[model samples]
Target chain A: MAKTRVPAIEGWFTTGDEPALVGSRGKETGSYFFPKSVAFSRNPAAPAEKLEEVALGRRGRIWSFTTNYYPPPEPYVAPDPFVPYTIVAVELPEEQMVVLGQLAEGADPAALKVGAEVELVLGTLYEDDEHEYEVWKWRPV
Target chain B: MTDVAILGVGMHPWGKWGRNFVDYGVAAAQAALADAGMEWRDIQFVSGADTIRNGYPGYVSGATFAQALGWQGAPVASSYAACASGATALNAARAQILAGLCDVALVVGADTTPKGFLAPTAGERRDDPDWLRFRLLGATNPAYFGLYARRRMELYGATPGDFARVKVKNARHGLTNPNARYRKEVTEDDVLGSPVVADPLHLLEICATSDGGAAVVIASTDFAKSRGTKAPARIAAISTVTPTYPNTVIEMPNFATDSSAGVKPPETTFRDSIAAKAYDEAGLGPDDLDVAEVYDLSTALELDWYENIGLCKAGEAEKLLNDGDTTLGGRIPVNTSGGLACFGEAVPAQALAQVCELTWQLRGEAGERQAEGAKVGLTINQGLFGHGSSVIVIR
Candidate 1:
């Protein structure tokens, strides 16, 4: 039986066929935030503006990328016999912000380059007996 | 701004001694006091940098160090600014002296870090950006360093070999630094051959965490003169500014850069503005600096700092390195006391350690690592969450 898919962290991103990161936009300034800033406006110039929930751009160009050779310390859950993964910083043209995400599984680090286009996708972050933990990942296009 | 004299600077050396943090702090404080030719009771104020790894004592480090040195009831202040903690503490003491609240102050920072990647506080807090980055993306400090290094490669044609050369130069400089943790000379090949911890950055290219402490004694110029000590190194400025709105560059422990979609990005990037503020207050520019001690968190980061601190233009750091302009005997020698490349990072202690190195150089007491006739010096570093650290010292 296939395990139930659950977001590794809830409300940060949607888990679906065409997933998009959940973010917030300042009502007054139009600035964007990932993982949604619910409390206040992060923009110093537009402080006190209300933030509205919005979906960030699903696609962006790679600003830079790196591959982590060693497993990071917990609360990072590593797979048994941990596999190395590439992390990418993607610049969203609409948001004008660079957001970091793990490159989707099986994407070759060598195949990636600065300015390469990538889209958001839900990937298995880890798994348990009854559930598959999913998190937002970047897939090179 | 009025200048605060650096009466003396001292360090307990950088190494993994595995001792209590207090031991290192006391030793460094004693050394600084002795170097200043003053008694412990003479200090009118104490400023200490906090270490998160240790418990309550580390939190109230100012009183901890004071009590360890037999408290004289001096007013105490403790600051925590991640890696910029030392500079924060130093600034606190400088403020008191400049405000005439005290004639003399002791500033100290020490840490005993764990082995391996510095982890976030043990918890499952989704709100903390530091924890979220590690839990969600598994991005370590070196990972950020790797990203910047790769960006350099793509934009300015920086090579792995160029990064290795930075380690090679720093290792050679560390050979003459008694306080340096890694004093052995290294070659470019040795650095390049080290195991890769992060792409485009080798294990040798990254700084390790170590147990260390550093301290400085600062006083008003009038106080220095009263003590019959003339011409001491004067702190011309200390810049502890935060990032302006729309900090476009991605910083550590953060999953995203601030969106510039709303406000126009600042003319100066966050890192560039760190030292710019210091230069503005000091009435000096990069050309005025005879020597510098910048945080080389990673070899490639040092190259980035060359441009960040205005030593050279962006994309021209590699050329500056190739020209030997930043080496020990060159124009505007940088990291002359080996920097974090050799000292490793004691977080709270590292920034003050930079000031200690500059004070030694300005006093003409630095032995083999001395930058000759170095009358002006600058130190710059950035801490997590927008803590900018920069200090300018002149003799």
Candidate 2:
């Protein structure tokens, strides 16, 4: 089996620990991706969406993406701080929704185009004293 | 409604000072009070635009600024509506004056922004869209801007050159502004030469974050006359309006747009919806505008504002821009104070700063960047997550 993806942020994954399976309560679009991720909740019900998992087959084109030139934020220490990684917005064919997530390791976002192929993967985000919020990520398929 | 006059307007310029936001705000507030010939204690009310300070303060901007100004026991109100924070503060001041609650009120906004991408404050919270975008998509504000600019290019046939010219025009205008952050002129070649942070948009096409503060003193018409002022540039309207839902549009700091599942979206774009509310309230149309100040977070967004503000019809921003209509001395000059492009992004203070520019232009005191014979002016700004602001001013 493919090496299990490790969570970038701990406890955000639904399946085996995978950096690809970061999970969060999907917002209004009703897919497995955050419509807009925020540090605080806009609605009272948002806290419940954290760490919930649904189907992941949704796929979409890369709307736009960027590569990490620096360490993303605190609590996320990679083996290499400057390692190149991609983030993509994949349009899900069945759900007709788009999910945003970090690209699989070694994927280059700079070379990707707007309509590039993309799919969802579970991800691992960092965790600390507070919480470990993981969710879905996008990668070129 | 009671008429209100601007007693004073002051700023801490627009640049990175590497200082705390409170310092900038206090400086601007003091200057405005001095200009208005009043002490800080004389002010009856204080309004502040909310910001993300070093410590988590929620959005208690009014109390924050009041504390910075040394707490004069005045009624404090903190207003948060994303980019419209400044204007919302202004509105609060106007309402206080018109309601006969207070004769003079101070409206201020200031921010000492964090370097690089503006992210949600720490701690894992999957519920907030602003934070989720960073954690999941790693999407920066520029990415949304790039997406919009690309969409503009695809839909409106706006070329990268067109986007570059916006920077050139705004920079030329900024070159004359004493308070603008970037005063040097930028050429189209300079824009093209810069590396593309997002495809179709070069580095020069984006705005940088800055530490800045702006404050305005608003008093009633009688209060201004009593203070020996004959005629002050007066505010006609402050539009702190929200968008009509289902918004059904993809905007900054949001991953997906309104589902369009529940209800029909309005015919006007979200930005335009803001201006429409202001125009309706002020009983003024776009044709009557002498000049305009818009949020140019990026080169393309400025063009987007042009259409939204009714300066031109949809998809014709490039035509107006190419004709030199948006430059100083054009039929309706825009961003005569160099706009966010030259001023950099100062968040809460930016929207109020737009009105400050208008007050100066309407008074014909803009010097090098003056819009000749300007009578009526408008400032349009929108904040992330659905906070929209537009203000109309007339001399």
Candidate 3:
């Protein structure tokens, strides 16, 4: 049932049983990954996981966040003059892990709080003339 | 370790240089060499506080300055300990001179920081502690400063006005300092009006990062006398120490503080510990200090430093500051050279610049800001990670 046709962390996670993987030498250890793509785990020697398998889907509570009013250094161009956005840590329950992602548009930091619920959505970070990179974004739920 | 004398010290005016950091470093080094009545080739070693070089060799400033000063073939060492980099460089140069490894050594630090919040390195690497803190907590450096500022207000009964008073006092002193970044007086009302960067801290309450440099020429006592330098400022002690385990309090850019699982933290704070070690090595108490240069990253932190350096009993810093004990003409002058608050943060170079100010104060050459007949001076700086540095200079 855990497979759900989604990508799973091979040799790490299995349904109804704790995920086990070979760690340091021949020793074996249990590891847990959340949203599988966001690789939050207790053990260092865990197998790569898929995002769909472990994802605590969509909207989560805002753990904490800060607005980058100031321009970031290098490679990141602001949306013209000042493109301010909140970098929020959202707590996902399915994996019981907190994930950090940029806040979506129309989300005002002044209205945000410690436990504010947020929704994860696919977003574009920035696009130069040559290429584009997909980024994860969060907005008020 | 061998005793070393601060034979010469110099600095360039700190501000928006809009130029390369190497140029400022070379200028400061030239001034120091000139002040020492020695040529660049006369120096035996060079140590610089390293800065992140954007693809330039100057990132490792020791070699950068060595090459800038025309390859003196002297031993060079580069150190980075956040704000404490300057003092760490001083300690390294002093060690070389004391070990008899080199008779004369030069310590220099400089940085041309890009404006605004210093962001973490670009990449998806989660293994780096610096990166993890930013990604997980969104805890900027100013956030930690705000935490300390808030704690000060809660514990010490310090008012927001009191923090502004530190800026006023330091800016007033900076008016006499040609090299200070801000040489004008500031008012408490002005501080109140400044926009908030963090909760309790206004724009003016926090120090701005700048591009600047400072250099000091340190030599063995014998070397100083031979060079016709008399009554040189002597470095009596240096503390380059780290904290004990179980550091519960959250430092800057850290997502979660220590869990306190293994062992208890020290009774004294990390800052206080650095000062205590310096005093022990120098065989002097806080009372012996005529002047001091402290890391005043924020106005509130300056008051905290007074307590950490044993200027007064804990919680008495506010009272002492209110009573003008830390002003230029007060009992124990702190930041007489206008500190980081007035001088601006130059990262790795700031701590070395603190000692330079101390050397001047100890030699009774601080002009208008001179602590009357000052005999002993101290400078303190705390770096990121687990590093800190303090130096006691006497004449």
Candidate 4:
């Protein structure tokens, strides 16, 4: 039997034709938070209210990016004989916030630059016998 | 309220020695005690910077160090705030002095870090943003530095050569300081030739991690007066401010910045607010600073701090460096102790090391790299987790 698919960290993204990242919108103050504010509102001016979960915009421009030369320590699952990968900070227009995610596989330093348009896609981080963990990655559009 | 006077300052020279942190803390504490012309028993209070990597004893470093020093039963407090742990320790001691709880308090910070990149503790806790940045994005600390360096290049036209120059300048100062980890001077070619850790930042331009210890003896002004010292370097002001809402800039250990949809960001940036608060309390401005020791985690970050500390206008830090205004014998020398570029960062001990430099400069004790006629000095450091601190010292 094939492994089950699950969000690497739940409540961050979903699977669809054009899956979008998840966030929360403050009904009182129009504030938006990624990973959806579950504890409390960060805004000082806004009173406490139930935040509505919303699917974030699919597209954004790369604000900045860098390729890591070394593998990050565990808790992070890197492929055997680890290959270096790039990370991009993407700025969503509607949210007016920069979200950081890994650039898609095969992406390198020469390809990405500031202000380049990027879109999100769900990718596998690592897989076990029972489940294939997934995370959001950025691809040059 | 009465003022707090730093009766003495001591540091076990920063290095990568494999000795235990407790020994370093004790050595620095003994040195400070001797310098203050007092015994350990005379200290009425003790405050220490907490090192998280160590076990539970590390969490209560104050009592740990106190017991190690033969336990006179002094009130103890331990504080932890990433790199600003030392400054937090200093403030804890200062509050005790100002409140008349202790006539004299001893502050100490020490750390023994690993060889390479400071990684998050081994865990599977997903809620921590620090761990998520690494596990999810593979964004190392230098990755953020690279982003900032690239942004500076695009926005301010800063070149790789300009970044290299900062290393050259600091390494030169490092040669004059006996305690620095890297004493060999580096040139612009050295910085450029170094392997790229992340996009715009080279390995040479980023600071390393090391083991070190620093301690200071602080007392009430009345106590200092009774000790027959008419003048001692005073901690005029300390700013321990948090970031304002709508934190636009993505800081270290954070996956993303706050969304700016509902509330507008504050005009005073996180770094700016720290310096402003210190200045307001000290009744002084940037013009009054004769010397400054800033956290230079990377060469580009140093330039950002140049503007953040009000040494220059927005986007004018490169010009300040080009004009020789920030070097020794200039308008105001920064990082006179060679900064983290040479000393490397020792976490809890780093901020206290900055204060030690300012204390030496204020007292005319800084030997070869001392800024001339330095009467007032300031030290600024920003740690992870929204902890920013600035300490102003005056003679």
Task: State the lDDT at B256 in candidate 2.
Answer: 62
Model number with the top DockQ: 1
Model 3 pairs in collision: A35-A54, A35-A55, B2-B98
**Fraction of native A-B contacts kept, per candidate:** 0.92, 0.15, 0.03, 0.70
Better of 3 and 4 by TM-score: 4
lDDT of 3 by residue, B330-377 (tens): 999899998887888988779888888888888778888888989998
Q: Which portions of model 4 show Cα errors greater than 4 Å?
A: A1-5, A127-132
Kindly list the per-residue Cα lDDT of model 4 for residues B26-59, writing each as its tens digit.
8889888888898999899999998887777788
DockQ (C-alpha based) per candidate is: 0.91, 0.19, 0.08, 0.74
TM-score of 4: 0.97
Fnat measured on candidate 3: 0.03
Question: Per-model C-alpha lDDT, please?
Answer: 0.93, 0.75, 0.74, 0.87
What lDDT does candidate 2 reach at residue A7?
41
* Winner on lDDT (1 vs 3): 1
- TM-score against native, each model: 0.99, 0.83, 0.77, 0.97
Candidate 1 lDDT tens digits, B222-307: 99999899799999999999999899999988899999999999999999999999999999999999999988999999999999
| lDDT score, candidate 3, position A26 | 11
Off by over 4 Å in 2: A1-3, A6-141, B1-3, B56-60, B67-70
* Superposition error at B25 for model 2 (Å): 1.3
**Which of the two, 1 or 3, has more DockQ?**
1
- lDDT at B182, model 1: 95
